[model samples]
Target: EIIAAIEGLMKDPAVGHPLKGKRVLVTSGPTREPIDPVRYISNHSSGKQGHAIAKAAAEAGAEVTLVTGPVSLADPVGVTVVHVESARDMLAAVEAALPADIAVFAAAVADWRVASVADNKLKKGAGGPPSLAFVENPDILATIAKHGSKRPQLVVGFAAETEAVVDNARAKLARKGCDLIVANDVAPGTGTFGGDANTVHLVTPDSVETWDRQSKDGVARALVTRLAEMIAKA
Candidate 1:
């Protein structure tokens, strides 16, 4: 009876759960830009952080939709998962899952793709190395964040930087038109790519707040709490 009373005291006074009935959309991992059937351009994102966030949001009672790129991690429980490969595919999936209450874009999408893909693999001895042209990929975060009709009420982006983390995040928050930017240092020795822990800075239009190093799951829970509070106040 005591434990039940304590739990009841800690529960939200309003909604049963903080994010009850809210729909959240999250993009995770790294989008690959294919060069050939066997080769592609991509990054080192493990989807651990993004997956953790989706899990935490589900725990918080939000209806979560996780749109992910190629990654090895298993899908989070109680969340709808959409697996995609290239940047274009990810963008299309995100568009199809629109009108969410909050959207967190955590995928490290490839910036460029080969302009012309070879039907056959270009051999090393072919013309003494073939030159390739590249073109920019669609900016998914910016497109969704600035959407006129289907934009989420709150849009968050991630900035993985090697230097000037907060400064770069601030710039990205403005450029991407997102409500917030979660910036982290993924430099050579940061162990942020596939590691368990992370140190992040929450950059918004008004200020920046730094968070201590913690496990990816811990960060996810903390972020969910913060977002829930923000929604309550809004």
Candidate 2:
């Protein structure tokens, strides 16, 4: 049964071969930064985009590992899935799954975490209010981009911007030291979160490719095809 599934994936036309025999790692969902045992900070990411990418990469004949944050989503077939909670945990999981040909940081990792987490949940009336201290979380994309060994040949990051989408994406591509950055606007009414469709700009070192808004599946397929071409040319 496993062999048949593998063969079926290999023969899928919507998939590509530039990534054949390669390994890909993808990070997805919103990382939780705990303030207390019962409270944490998180975002609204639904994990659809990253899951789609994982599925597409696997269908393209690549060994895909998805290091994901807590999300109520089903695992993509043919992809290895690792579940994590906090931003720090997600970073650790991605590092452990490394040495891939491609790494895509699609997770909306919280930039900051509580400096100290309370062992127990804070209760009202103990104090007027509880104060929280914050510290920066590790930049997983940058870390992988600059890994000492087995650094992926291609690194991709996502810029979920509410304004200045293209500009921010371009800056992130440079700042994160990734080969490409996909920028998308999450403005009100954009329907980026918990939506099946997306429109994004692919920012590279020298060019920006704007893709028409389409279903997440369509975007995933296109990205896999592009990755295949890049691997073939590399």
Candidate 3:
């Protein structure tokens, strides 16, 4: 069934010729910043959306590479999957997997990491607790978007905002120097993180397209179709 779907996409002129022979890269899941051997900081991303995008792009006839953070999902057929744990690892992995025609930053990377990693578990003090300092992690999306060589022709970013979705998304798009930004609310009651459904606003410099809440697969198909069109025109 999956192969048949991919064959159908390959035969579809609108999606086929545009992505034919092109290389695409995608990032997914949550980066784990180690606090200790047994603990880490990460997000709630399930990597469903990113996986779907990789599948769709492969169906569209592109050579796809997925740089994923920790996730348990099976790798999509016809796509190269590189697994990484920390935000720094993800960044390095993505840089090494470059020369892609399009790059999608879909991973929910942690903003900070423990400044110092203890060699062994720290025991609680008699008086109080340990103070762990944190440092900012590299912004993967911004870094790839601004790379000098082997830069993707098109760069897209995901803005998982909790409030002011459109405004924050717009800011992220501009700040990250990405061509498109998919902004979605992850507030409580919204089934975004680890959920099958999503409601997102696609923000570009010229316009904003708000999509009705839909399944993650639906969103992936829609985004891939649009990407095919954009690449065809480019």
Candidate 4:
């Protein structure tokens, strides 16, 4: 952390815009799957990490487009923000923000949504609980990553897991066909869902690099740096 702080302080502001001519797309927060007008199925993602990445990208001079779900945080200055609710809505917004030089999938989109939505709020009744039919939501990460020509040059993904963090991320890296997977543990008590910091492992096809715990903003800045290097190498 000390070294990271020193590196950050040492970075020359004049050379900050390494991605000056680049375009970036980032997704944040958890998509809500509505069960009724008053109830929904969603995770605990806070959009902190995603928002930080979008902000860092803009600071690097990239033309950034942020597609986010319901979050209380203010929109990042200089970023084009697209607000979405359900997973399907998020998918549409993401598809619309295309042709990015780099794409980051940071949102914890719901895997399934209620097949049939209730028109009004559900109330207590003799029937203990109402049965719900769920259907798979669109695979946004894989869809964008597999897009032939419209696919971004660099695709990044995130894996929030309770166990086998690196292993799961490695599998996801192949399954989703993304260039990188930022893996972290979001199991109960990790405070990752709404926390300010993260400890992540950068998983790729060839290797895994574990980074020390740091602020979400710090991870974003460091990620942007790595992305610049990756794109340059490509």
Q: Judged by TM-score, which candidate is best?
A: 1
Off by over 4 Å in 1: 1-7, 10-16
RMSD of 2: 4.8
All predictions: root-mean-square deviation over Cα? 1.9, 4.8, 4.1, 4.5
Task: Estimate, for each residue in 88-203, the C-alpha lDDT of model 1 and write its tens digit.
Answer: 99999999998899999999988889998777776798469677799999999999999988989899999999999999999999999999999999998999999999999999
User: So what's the TM-score on candidate 2?
Assistant: 0.92
Error of model 1, residue 170, in angstroms: 0.7
Q: Tens digit of lDDT per residue, candidate 3, span 1-234?
A: 999999998778755545778899999999998877777778899999899889888887789999999898999999999999999999999999988999988889998999998877767779688788999999989998888787798899999988999999998888988899999999978978999998989999999999999998899878988887787688
Clash pairs, model 3 backbone? none
* lDDT, candidate 2, at 34: 83
Best by lDDT: 4
Per-candidate local distance difference test? 0.92, 0.90, 0.89, 0.95
For 163-230, candidate 2 gives per-residue lDDT tens digits of 99999999988998889998988887999988999998999999999999999899998998898888
Clashing pairs in 1: none
TM-score of each: 0.95, 0.92, 0.92, 0.93
Candidate 2, run of 10 with poorest lDDT:
10-19
The lDDT ranking, best first, is 4, 1, 2, 3
